[model samples]
Target: MVSQVDNVITIARPSETPAPRAWQRPFLKWAGGKYSLLPELDRLIPAGKRLVEPFVGGGSVFINSDKHASFLLADVNADLINLYQMLAIVPEQVLTFARRMFTSLNSERGYGIVREEFNAQRIDSIERAAAFLYLNRHCFNGLIRYNLSGQFNVGFGKYRSPYFPQEEIKTFANMAHNCVFMNAGFQKTLALAGEGDVVYCDPPYEPMPGTAGFTNYAAGGFTWDDQQALARCCVAAHERGARVVISNSTAPRIIELYKGHGFDLHHVSARRAISSKGSTRETATDIVAIL
Candidate 1:
């Protein structure tokens, strides 16, 4: 019931894992999802000081993170935050929403109705959360793409399926009960700083000059200016004694953006399988800041 109005960074060391619950599905099809790289995150940060993630995409890390100050989670996407809020606050509503969405997902008409329900209630934090899982379960490629105007644009995908599993709904709901979800910008979440808070930001990456077409998740272009602003906020948090981790493109400009900012740079491989031609895109890396 409390809110983080001031910036207090806390670094928490995660040495224990949460007891496993049933909800076991990734809701959204996040681009830089940490499902595979979880061990790496645990190794670098290890659930230190008040666990915080501003960008908390897909929640692979948050759900998996070692228990900290409960957990503080936030995101700019209203629908996404709604899902978290439903999970944290009123989990049964999420169950109803999930059941309704799944039950009505067979035909195109039913899918459209479900989508309408999601878009219509996206402004409601809890509903948006349940709708998030619903749409992501039914959307094509689990890809959460938005048009320039911010409309969910990805169509249905290959396999005839609904990604939401039966038991996962309740499991995820239980996990949601442990954290606080906010439909706010990443800064608000990062601003919540006290000693030992580990803040990981996976904001939209800065596009390189030569790169052609990249996936755009929001209506906003996630411009260079936004990246710069985020960098400044992160520096401020770091100065306040919070440990920070950020994932960004490997472009020279992106690398320079964090230059001398006190982050230990590590080159990590990324498989750009969005197009799924199965090609490998090397030179991807993660920037870790905790000094």
Candidate 2:
């Protein structure tokens, strides 16, 4: 039976075992990351030949899951995909670069310089990857925001010291060896799913009442049309015999959209971490649609 906390639903499978390695943790600190939801999510994810995540934010699900199947991780953010690709191919180099940033250049001034350089878009792939990681770790609340011109604009978090995810990156690199990274849209990425594949999508959630929206991480933010299009993609993938799982806000429109398509919907309580006011960090209901 599914459990409910307030308006949130929780599904727990008693047979699931604990994760064996520490390396299974996500390498990045993402705002809407599913790290906290991993336990409940474990019950819903089905075993398949390949795991495809169309919106692999912080890769919490991918990093923690069993590695029996290969992975196809894609995101519309080219910088994010490029970082993952580099991590998969040259883990040691990436680790070295990150360590240098953490050890010698982790101050506010250092972060500002790197952020400026990254915004300028004049750096190479490796440097860009390193800067992405650095900014994400050092940025305010791990938020990745962009201006109308597609430049990173989040400010520093001002923490005395932020933890560098060296071990997490190593683990991600090792696991990513059997994975394919793509810088493509969700529809295109979901099209690659076929029979014996499992697809999990965690798109930007619809904003709750009196809360801020965060769909602008990319230049062109996800709109209502994009959400509807995503539903169609999930339905098509399921029709192709792929097990599809999607997570989004428990908005009325979202419920109507997935339910109209005959996808089984579940609810879960999600904590808001990116709000400007601490009082606004209340529990919010989210939906999990399994097709």
Candidate 3:
């Protein structure tokens, strides 16, 4: 059974149609991606005037949900945002560059060369976007990590071959034709979200105690302070009459932080995929807060 928050009445599943439209999927493989939870998210999402996502990692929620009156998608990761912007504006060119890289490179050696060039900043935005896509598809477990200097540092996955989602890219490009992309902090993005909008926050999960959390997706990794700032932002957005939803680890601090903030909280089971040990990769509870 699907988990729900805030006593939401689950919408009945629609009957099958003879020719159902193909659902678009996220083109990037993001850690902590919410693609699997789209159905639950769809139920909570009020019919939107605009959809604002400050942490649009992999864009799983955005791609799976219904098109809003408008969209404001932003992230702190410039390259990721640039990739989406380029896809929306110059998809054919991005696709061409991606195909060339995919056809000409497959081995660890080839990946190393591309990674070096990507880090060197010797290519144009379109080519860099294509390289980023290639690296994400072929990287180890689709983990996007950066070094202290903010360089792409994930190693190759050594797969026999990786499938490039050319059609998915085109689909997303068309879908995001009217969406606005920004490389801004979460607070700045949320500030633009106001009445008649839905804001979904999927910030990096608060790390478990005594463990170095996976916040290195970009420079200046998210900290507990950032988490508190986000909670305040969510409250501000709620006060402004925007529907807000947030996903985070079921950490005690997280539970306590939002408990008295007039938000409904529920726990849902989610898979842990980023673990290096197969034994450690198991289902865990994730908290969902609806305001």
Candidate 4:
């Protein structure tokens, strides 16, 4: 059935929604992260042996939900995947380097130096992963944008003091045992979905009118063609016996795409902190489609 509801909010608290269980917060701050929308998503996600995410932005779904026995988390960003790998492999070492960076390199000049070093790839894998965590906290709005050349190009956030998510990092490290991180695009990742797997997709939202979309989480930005292909892929996975759920902007085209595919769509207001200023922060209309 095709369904659409405006300003629907299932999540308990808009400002701070506590998880049913202990919160497994991700270290990185993402633009369209699912941390706040977990309650609405949980209502839509079906039972499955494995939880698969093709566009695991900040990993809020997998980390928070205990419904799945295992998780297959994949993203197009290699650096992000690398950070997950390092955290899974060497938690203490990552914590050590990240702690040092957070304490010592908290300045705009320091942030610039680290950003250059991160792009240059001069450091080891563990250190590079730690550097990414540092950049995420200090960068403007915690954005991870890359230029056409694949260089991290976000400006420094002039926050008085950026927070160091040590507990969040440790929690992620502890939970990494049950997750398989992949540095792959959504196509490759969604192809792995099958019977008894619940695939949750949080792809970059289709840009709203008069606004340039924030699709540059990696080198090559996601495009309209990519959005169409992703919808097709989700449909294919659903046909293959996997229960699929997707989160995207309530853009006319996006709503039409899911409706045409026979998805059950629920519209909700998602609070976004993309803007640096408090007054500019607003609730955006987003859709949760179950297939």
Candidate 5:
């Protein structure tokens, strides 16, 4: 039997690149996510410890973080969390669903039908992963916003035929397999860590006076109370000897909120919006390297 490390991709087959370390796709397209900002985050990784990312948005850090830790990944979005849980625990099911969705795509109507069909089913990982993919690809600019009723609220994208293949998705499945997946709110995940663990918090960004329209993706926008709660979680984690890092909009509200909260706040510039016409959104600073 070939092990997962076997660097063998048979002819007529690709996309099975052997991963020296497990890397899972961050299952959601978070509005203010920083998958493209890992270089900025690289400066802040603590030398060695088990790793945890409470927000784990698109898993930019969890999947790419040096690969030397007992990872605990969590998110608040149920379907998003379920998709990762499925990828970690059930890759084959996800692959099957991906292929089926690819073959079934004919029109926007077909995509909506599939979403409704899967959304009504029991909380199965495979179906959830496929639905998540479909929404991300078809939804406006890959935003994962939803309606208050829990229906995906992202409008159809400009793409005509959207398809995710079996081989490419297997990578996501293996990622889920490599780490522990959770549906807990950010605090619950933090509560599980201790001295030898490292937690990277990528909570949703807070809006500032000049850039108030930055966060509008999730069904219910994240709140100031949640931000305070996250800061407390980080402080508690710190007291337990764990290192905490946060990537969020460096707005005055956030900066003032965490000032002297025992964290070193550093500002790094980031693009503020993802709108059509590629809206020349404001370039704003976000912070990391929380001490």
Candidate 6:
């Protein structure tokens, strides 16, 4: 059986049918990654010739879903895009350099040194990309934050052992063969959408009330005006015959923004582990809007 809400289609399979195993997992541990919401996201995604992700945070949704023949993944973060580009061009080299860095710089002091080098822009692209991966794994809570001066500023993670995702990197490289990654903002990426495209956006979520909203994934944090602009872009893409799906916090303003644009909202519980304190981490309501 199947159900449709607006244009969003979801399959209701027989109880006897076994769930499909995840095809791939993202190597990076991003803050707002969609790994846990794959089942819901996959159901909402409509069939299309290509999948377009304007905010490809961790590359989990694109990596796991096999519905699209090609992908256009974009993000505002240049370092993240450079890492993906390098992986697509030279997976083995990235794997080798990252493996070495993980082994050599697996301490707090080493982390500080590498963070300094990465911010200083002293290393080549390949090495810098490796350092980015290393910092993402070893830094606190896998945060990719930067200061106003555009320097990597997250502290040491202090993990017992950060696993080197060799297989995950290789898997992403193979998948990247049909992908085009760009270092661009959501507006520019969404403007390119047209017929036969499915745009899935996982932007830095709007912070709920009474919570310290952590939108500073990049230097210029996402603002209310930016969120409004994103909503406008999604509506424009939908009007151009493309399917659009967006994930965001269930903030009142966020809900009102999507509702006003005629998007169908599907709320789901997402366990957020980005909090500094473990006790503060709990299940939060997230809305997946489709048009």
Per-model tally of clashing residue pairs = 29, 0, 0, 0, 4, 0
Worst 10 residues of 6 by lDDT: 16-25
RMSD each, Å: 11.7, 8.8, 8.1, 9.3, 9.6, 7.7
Q: Model 6: per-residue lDDT, tens digit, 65-173?
A: 7899999999999999999999999888888888898888899999999999999999988988899999999999999899998898999999989988888998899
TM-scores for all candidates?
0.80, 0.89, 0.90, 0.91, 0.82, 0.92
The 10-residue segment with the lowest total lDDT in model 5: 20-29
Please report the TM-score between candidate 6 and the true structure.
Answer: 0.92
* TM-score ranking of the models: 6, 4, 3, 2, 5, 1
Looking at model 2, residue 14 earns an lDDT score of 77
Supply the TM-score for candidate 2.
0.89
Query: Which scores better on lDDT, 1 or 5?
Result: 5
Candidate 3 residue lDDT tens string, 1-291: 355679875666767677834556788888898876776667677778888999998998787767476788999998899899889889999999998888889989999999999999999999999999999998998899989898999999987878899778877887887689999999999988889999999999998767677887998899999999999999999889899999998778888888867779978878887876668887888888999
- Model 4: what TM-score? 0.91
**Highest TM-score scorer:** 6
Clashing pairs in 4: none
lDDT of 4 by residue, 194-288 (tens): 99999999999899878898888888888999999998999999889999999999889989988999999998889987888879889888999
lDDT (Cα, tens digit) per residue for candidate 1, span 130-217: 6667667676657787777677776655346665664655656666666777777866777786567778787876666787545376
lDDT of model 4, residue 147: 93
Total clashing pairs in model 1: 29
lDDT by residue (1-291, candidate 2, tens digit) is: 699999999988778786754435688878888887877787788888899999998999988888337999999988899899988887778778877887776778988988989999888888789889988988888898888899999888876788988777777877887789999999999999989999999999877656667799789999989999999998999999999999999778889999999999988887877776778887877889999
Identify the runs in model 3 with alpha carbons over 4 angstroms from their true place. Answer: 1-23, 276-280
Relative to the unseen true structure, what is the C-alpha lDDT of residue 259 in candidate 2, on a scale of 0 to 100?
A: 94
- How accurate locally is residue 241 in candidate 6, as Cα lDDT from 0 to 100? 89
Error of 4 at 26 (Å): 2.0
